[model samples]
Each structure stands twice: as structure tokens, then as C-alpha cells.
Target: MSSATIRCYIGIGSNLDVPLEQVKQALLELRELPESTLIQHSSLYLSAPVGPQDQPDFVNAVAEINTHLEAHALLDELQALEQRHRRVRVQHWGPRTLDLDLLIYGNESIQTERLQVPHPFMTERNFVVYPLAEIAPDFIFPDKTPLSDYLANCPMGKLKQIQI
Candidate 1:
């Protein structure tokens, strides 16, 4: 019997050098991952940097994908992509050439030494929720709350759609 497809949401962002170009490139790269297909993507948004706010504003988006890989393997692929984009690990939430986060993984809850599923902070970031809602308006939180309801109550920042 064929295994059911896993639905995943990924958060992408860039704030160093050519931010838009990096986002575009990251999307294309995501489309190329093995055993995976890019399903939907939200428009890009420009947002003030979170965490350490000493750097440039970020260009962010969320993408929905269908994949066959298990969670940690997917995380490995994301990290490999980050290395390709020259992502630096020197600072928390620092400037980056590309940032790809596996925000949700088929309702699975994972806690590991190097990874976390259902991303610990997805709900609090417009960079994540807005794009997610654009694609899957009815997505449910780990707590079983409707995403649309959360979006309705969220004070997320303005997000602009940029054509790829």
C-alpha cells in the first residue's frame, strides 16, 4: 500500500544582500527537493527583523509542500539548503542569505536535540501565519484552533505580495 503524503509548511526569509533574489532562488530550490513538490506559496512580505533587530528588514513568505521524507530528513535538507545560501550561524535571528524553516509537518509533534516540529513560534509571526492563511485558510494549530480564527485575532504586520 502507498503511504499517505505528508503536508508541510515552510517559512522562508532573507535579509542579506539581494533579499528578493534569495527568496526566489529558495523557492526554486524547494521545488527541486527529492520526493517533494511545492504546493502553494504566499506573496512575499517585508517585515522588521525580529530577535536581534540590529540588521536589515526581512523579505519573507510561507510555502506549502507535499513530501514523502520523514521529519528529520526534511530538516536535514533544509539545513543543507541553508548552507548553500551561505546562512551563518553566528547569531540568533541574525542576517541571512536564506532561511528555510519547517513550520509544520503533518500535525506531528517532534522535539529533538536539533529540531522542533510545529515550529515553536509560528503563531506569533506574520511572516509565517499570513502566507499560511493565504494557502490553507483553515489550517489548525497543534491546540486544534482554526488558523483563520487566529489570523483574525492576530496583529500581524503588513505583508505585500511580490510577483515571482
Candidate 2:
């Protein structure tokens, strides 16, 4: 039997000093994950912080990666990369030099103390939905809803797509 390929989406953001540069580096590192291929990247976007409004807004975007690794293994690799980049999870929605969140893993729905698939607020956050739609316009949620349709009804954030 051939190995199964899993498609995973990653939401990347940075809000502290030199965020753009940090985000760029993070993307390069993500491309290095084993058994993975960086499929496509959404244009970079700048958006206001989600919760606890005191922090700086983040530079956000989404990327689609094809991997042979299982969902939990991908999560572990992402967390390892975050730690390597000095991501400190001290507070909820805190500012960071880089944040990498696993947004989706194939059609898998996972819930555990450490992770959740399709993310918890993917449809609600323009930062996540917009960029994800940019790269994977036809991607469907577990509920069989098209991403573009979901984005049409979500609250819009201040989004600026950076020209590469």
C-alpha cells in the first residue's frame, strides 16, 4: 500500500518587534519539516490582535503543507519549531515574535488538552480564514461548508495583503 498524504494548514503570525522578518524566517523553517512539502502560501496580511486588545497587531498568513506524518506528529513538529524560535506561551493571546498554529489536518477532527483540529476559531478570525481561503479556496470544513462561503459571513478584520 502507498503512504497516505495528509494536507495540513498552518496559521502563522508575529506581533512583537520586527514581525515581518520573524514571520519570514518562520516560514523558511516550516518548509524544512521532514516528510512535508510546502504547497502554497497566502499573501501576508496585517491584522489587529484578536483578544486582550492591548498587544500589537500581528502580521498573519496561512500556508498549506502536504505531509506523510500523522496529525499528532505534525503538531509535535510545529511545537518543536516554535520552541526553537523562542515562542513563550505565558498568556493567552500574548504578543510573540512568532506563532504557528495548526489550523487543519486533512479531514481529521482532533481534540485534546494540547491540540484541536480545524482550530477552535478558524471561521471567526478573518486573519485565519482570509489567508486560508487565499491558498485553498475550495477547502471545506468538517461540516462540508466551503471556506469561501464561511469567510463571506465572518466578521471582517483590517486585512492588507503584502505584495511579494
Candidate 3:
């Protein structure tokens, strides 16, 4: 963790073990992360599963936070949250009790064995893009493209906003 606060974005999703409840509970926990403050969160959106269609659709949202934790430390906190929610990774993009992805860490572009800031698939997934754009419309990617540009490419035809 660092002494300086850093603004970060996180992608959240769940489709098992009462998906909506999982998201809601995770949000509550997120607000209490050590050295972190959850600034804002986007409305939950229902989206089709990215992998096997045999599972339930996902409930997704993005959260913005200010934290003293560095990128990797933030990721550790997110994973711990997921574990608390009983998340299990049996398959890629599979159904879970909760999933937390560190989408961006300030202006950093990180690629380590354990984490990747500016999540690799955020721009391509409406689930990630729409919520992110909703809260941080002015955010620019590490590539310098505005967040709206990615949102434009993401079609929300199948993504439905969950009435909170």
C-alpha cells in the first residue's frame, strides 16, 4: 500500500448464489476495504454469459474508488472479497458467487503475473464498458482513447440495467 491515494475502477459480476445479493453484499464490503473509500458505483446491468451458455446470465457493475493501496495490493483485496463471497474458479468466465476485476489503477498500465490494470477485455464487453462509462464518462484509456469511444463500440442491446 502507498501513502498516496489512487483512483481506481473495479468490475464486479456474479451469476450464482443469489447473484443480486452477491453484488449488493460485495458493494457493502468494498466500501470498507482497508485504506480505501468507494467513491461511486454504476447501476447493475444484466448481461449474457461470456463463456458456456449453460449457466445463468450475469449481474454486473463497475465501481470507482480512491485507495492508498497500490495496484497489486488492490487486486489482493478484491480477490479476498471474492473469496469471502465463496467464489470458485472452475472454468474461465464461469458462473460464480462473485467476481471482482481491477479495471484501472489510476493512470497505470500494469501487466504482471498477478494483475493487469486497464482490464484486457473491458473495452470489448458491454457489461464492463457501459457501467464504467456511466460513472467515469471522462476516463481515458492508457492508449489515450476516451472511455466513450469504447462504449460506442459496445452494443447494449442485450445488456439490461437492473432496477436497484
Model 1: colliding residue pairs: none
Question: 1-164, model 1: which lDDT tens digit per residue?
Answer: 11668999999999997999899899999999888999978888888898997898889999999999888888899999999998888898889999999999898888998788888888888778888898898898777989988688767766566666
Local accuracy of candidate 3 as per-residue lDDT tens digits, 30-119? 999999999999999999999799999999999999999988888888999999988889999788999999999988899899987788
For model 2, give the 10-residue run with minimal summed lDDT.
155-164
**Clashes in model 3: which pairs?**
none
Show how many residue pairs clash in every candidate, following the order shown.
0, 0, 0
Comparing candidate 1 with candidate 2, which one achieves the higher TM-score?
A: 2
The CA root-mean-square deviation of candidate 1, after full C-alpha superposition on the true structure, stands at: 1.9
- For candidate 1, the per-residue lDDT at 163 reads 68
Q: What value does the lDDT take at residue 25 in candidate 2? A: 84
Deviating ranges (above 4 Å) for candidate 3:
none
Q: TM-score: which candidate is best?
A: 3
Q: Highest lDDT, which number? A: 3
Least well predicted 10-residue stretch by lDDT in candidate 1: 155-164
C-alpha TM-score for every candidate: 0.93, 0.94, 0.97
> Over all chains combined, what TM-score does candidate 3 have?
0.97
Model 2 lDDT per residue over 54-160, tens place: 99879998988999988878888988887887888988888887888999988889999989988998888898988888888888888788997888897665777
